[model samples]
Target: MGAGLARFARNRMALFGAAILLGLLLLVLATPALFPGDPFRLVGPALQPPGGRFLLGTDTLGRDVAAQIAYGARTSLLIGVGATLGAILFGVIVGGLAGYYRGAVEIVLMRVTEFFQTIPAFVLAILIVAILSPSVTSEIIAIAAVSWPGIARLVRGEFAALGGREFILACTGLGASDARIIFRHMLPNCTAPIIAVGSLLIGTAILIEAGLAFLGLGDPNVMSWGLIISAGRAVLRSAWWICTFPGIAILLTVLAINLVGDGLNEALNPRLRER
Candidate 1:
């Protein structure tokens, strides 16, 4: 763990990405106190350009674009983290069981996972959100339902590989329960890959949520980057700032997360670290 941290710290791009993400997180946390304005409420004249009063300008609805981005950061991060956690939990359980047990358990779980994998993830997510209702919670569920199959496959591979290792066999010989061997002895060994994958998964979750919101399937009550872009699309020629600023925010955030994930992957993988 310490070595992995050291390697990650040494990566300049990773540090840069971490800095960007941290700044975004601070902005999100400070928005309520610093801005202290309603993101949805009309604050000024509609279609205002970036300058003087509004840092990012007013949207078509006369709401502060900057505030919307700030608030949207909160929404995006919330959904991203929430959906990622749910996916990871479901994936770990399904993958762990299948990999540790193999045989019928593996066959059944893998087939189910493959069934999900066969569907187009974004399309499936859209269908799920449409059925469940357009809300943050629904978006989380949809993203998780679609995203877990990848994580399940990753975990299943790790477990299958680790299950045959000497230490795992030794643990089994020591009379450890299957659960103990799986969770304690096996899971820990592959946690680096899981963490790396989970980081990437968060970024994917955020992107999916944004896409859903762009399609007008996001929570109507919450201000999100995608919603901002969707609202500004019609007025793009005249009020470019409305969409441009939020679009930039999404791009930078997703890029930063991907950089961090890549860094983690390199730091955690022994072969990559050696290279």
Candidate 2:
């Protein structure tokens, strides 16, 4: 783990990404203190550009863009981390059961996983959000519902590969229970790749949530980056700052996440460690 940390720290782009994420984290933590009251409140002059009164500017309705972003950071991080964790949890359970048990279990679970994979993930997420109605909880569930198939496949493959190993065979021969062998032994070995993939999934989840919010499927009561963009799309040419900042927010956040994810992949994989 120390060696892996060293490798990760050496990656300049990853370090930059980490710095960006750290700033965002600080922003998220200080949101309440920095910008009190409802972020949706009309707090300034309409169509205000970046200036003294409004740091980032104001939207058509005179809401502070900076405040919206600070509040939206909470929404983005919540949906991204929440959805990714949910997917990973459910995927490991389903995939672990299928891969360890194999036979009928693998066949059934893999088929269902494939069904999800065949559909367009964005479409599926939209459908889910639509059905459940737009809210943070529904958005997380929607993203997780669309996102789990990949994790499921990854886990299934890892477990399947590990199953044929001598260590596994020895565990079985030594009268180790299936649950014990899987939970205590096999699962830990799969953690590296899982962490790598999960990092990337967070970025994807954030993008999807942003897309949903842009389509006006987000929770209506709260401020969000996507909602900010959506509100400004009409006056994009005249008030480019309104959408531009939030768009940049989404882009930078996603890029930073991807960079960190790539670094994690390199650090975690022995084959890529030297590179």
Please identify model 1 stretches exceeding 4 Å from their true place: none
Cα error, candidate 2, residue 59 (Å): 0.6
- Model 2: per-residue Cα lDDT at residue 7: 90
Q: CA shift at 173, candidate 1, in angstroms?
A: 2.0
- Candidate 2 global CA lDDT score: 0.94
Give the alpha carbon lDDT tens digit for every residue of 142-247 in model 2.
9999999899999999999999999999999999998899999999999999999999999999999999999999999867888889999999999999999999
Candidate 2 displacement at residue 213 in angstroms: 0.7
Per-candidate TM vs. native? Answer: 0.98, 0.98
- lDDT, model 1: 0.93
